[model samples]
Target: MNAFEEEREMMLRVQQADFVVVELTLYTDTHPEDAEALGQWREAIKEAAHVRRQYEKRYGPLSLLSVPTEQAIELGWRWNSTPWPWQR
Candidate 1:
């Protein structure tokens, strides 16, 4: 695949992972006593982090919460760079 296609696919994966984490967090909030849901929520958080790291390693970062890599710095990626998430 070309660079754009690869970036889109990775971004989609990151979005999906983040969606799962958010949903699970909401579920756990109302069902805190459910051990199964709590476990799933924890796993979701880890999965989201993994997906985010994979994307950021190549595309700089999705947000400032992530520390920029040396490679990203060398590539001249900045927080205010164009094609932000909505623009993308």
Candidate 2:
């Protein structure tokens, strides 16, 4: 695939992983006694981090919370340099 396609695909994966984490967090908040849901929520967080790392490795970062890579710094990547996810 071309660069844009690859970037879009990775971004989608990131979004899906984040969605799972958010949903699981809400579920756990309401069902705190559910060990199964809590476990799933923990796993979801890890998966989301993994997906985020993969995307940032290729496309800088989705947010400022992430540490910028040396290459990205040298390349002058700023948050305003590109469109945000919703803007895209």
Best by lDDT: 1
Q: After superposition, how far is residue 54 of candidate 2 from its true place, in Å?
A: 0.5
lDDT of 1 by residue, 1-88 (tens): 9988888999999999999999998999999999999999999999999998888887777776775666566787666778775566
In model 1, the number of clashes is 0
lDDT against the true structure, per candidate, is 0.84, 0.83
Best by TM-score: 1
Stretches off by above 4 angstroms in model 1 are 72-76, 85-88
- As a whole number from 0 to 100, the lDDT of residue 68 in candidate 2 is 69
RMSD of each: 1.9, 2.1
* lDDT digits (tens) for residues 12-87 of candidate 2: 9999999999999999999999999999999999999999998887767677787566546788776776575445
Error of 1 at 86 (Å): 4.7
Candidate 2 local lDDT, residue 65? 80
**Total backbone collisions for each predicted model:** 0, 0
Residue 66, candidate 2: Cα error in Å is 1.0
